[model samples]
Target: MITWLTIIGMGVITYAIRLAPIVLLERFALSPALRQALKFVPVAVLSAIILPELIMPGGGVDVSLANGRLLAGLLAIFVAWRTKNVLWTIVVGMVALWLL
Candidate 1:
């Protein structure tokens, strides 16, 4: 249970983190090579964090084929690949999970 002040403090901290990059990077101009490399940094970092959650969310890191979340996530990925729409992917994943 988060208190109001705690939530507000988290919001303030998050705000500061969000603003920090703009404030710090405003005066700098990145070179083309560096800019291209930097563009992938966020995706790499986000994938580093999200991949485990998608496939091995149980914290035990048990990647057995019997895992329901892994199956559901694969179904979601297939749906996303076929439809190229998040709404459809979510709907299909929900249906798969509900029926499982």
Candidate 2:
């Protein structure tokens, strides 16, 4: 009983935590510059999260051609740039990683 109650309480708390930001921000009108900057936030955040893993698969920096992840990531970037297709980029990256 206590475990279930704790889980329910945590679910409510998590929902409130996520909902509060949207509720509060809805009242304010963001500036054009801020809105434009927000467009890049996802990309920046993703890069910050993903770059380390690709560059340091073994917990140490490795930028050499021997690093499969780094190589695959580069190929993925190229595919994304040229094709502008997320699906192709992911498929190519995964295949490149497997081959490497």
Candidate 3:
């Protein structure tokens, strides 16, 4: 009973924490510069999350050919740059990783 209650309480708290931003931000208008900068937020966040795993798969930096993730990430980067297609990039990256 206590575990279930704790989980329910955590759910409510998490919901409120996420909802607070939307509720509070709705009242104000953001500046044009700030809005434009917000466009890069997703890219920055994604890079932050993905670059570490690709560059350092085993808790240490690995930039050589032995690193499958690094090679796959490089291929994905090239695909994204050349084709600008998310689907192709993902497919190629996954296939490369599996092969490597």
Candidate 4:
């Protein structure tokens, strides 16, 4: 019972923390510059999260060609740039990684 209560409490707190920002933002308008800057936040955040794993798969820096994730990432980048298709980029990247 304690474990379940703790899980529910954490869930409620997490939801409230996420929802508070959206609720507050809706009540106030942000500056155009701030909005523009926020537009890059997702990309920047994703790069910060993903680039490290791709460039350094074994927990240490490894930028060599032998890195499967790095090669797969390059393929995904190429597919994304050329086809501009998110689905295809993911599929190709996954298949390339599997093959490598």
* Backbone clashes, each candidate: 0, 0, 0, 0
* Cα lDDT over the full model 3: 0.94
Quote the positional error of residue 12 for candidate 3 in Å.
8.1
Ranked candidates, highest TM-score first: 4, 2, 3, 1
Q: Please tell me which predicted candidate would have the highest TM-score against the true structure.
A: 4
Question: Candidate 2: where are CA atoms >4 Å away?
Answer: 1-26
TM-score of each: 0.64, 0.70, 0.70, 0.73
Candidate 1 lDDT over 15-83, as tens digits, reads: 986787688897555679988998999979987986797677777776776677777778988998899
Looking at candidate 2, what is the lDDT of residue 52? 98
Against the hidden true structure, what lDDT does model 2 obtain?
Answer: 0.94
Which residue pairs in candidate 2 collide?
A: none
As a TM-score, model 3 comes out at 0.70
Error of 1 at 59 (Å): 1.0
- Runs in model 1 with CA error above 4 Å? 1-26
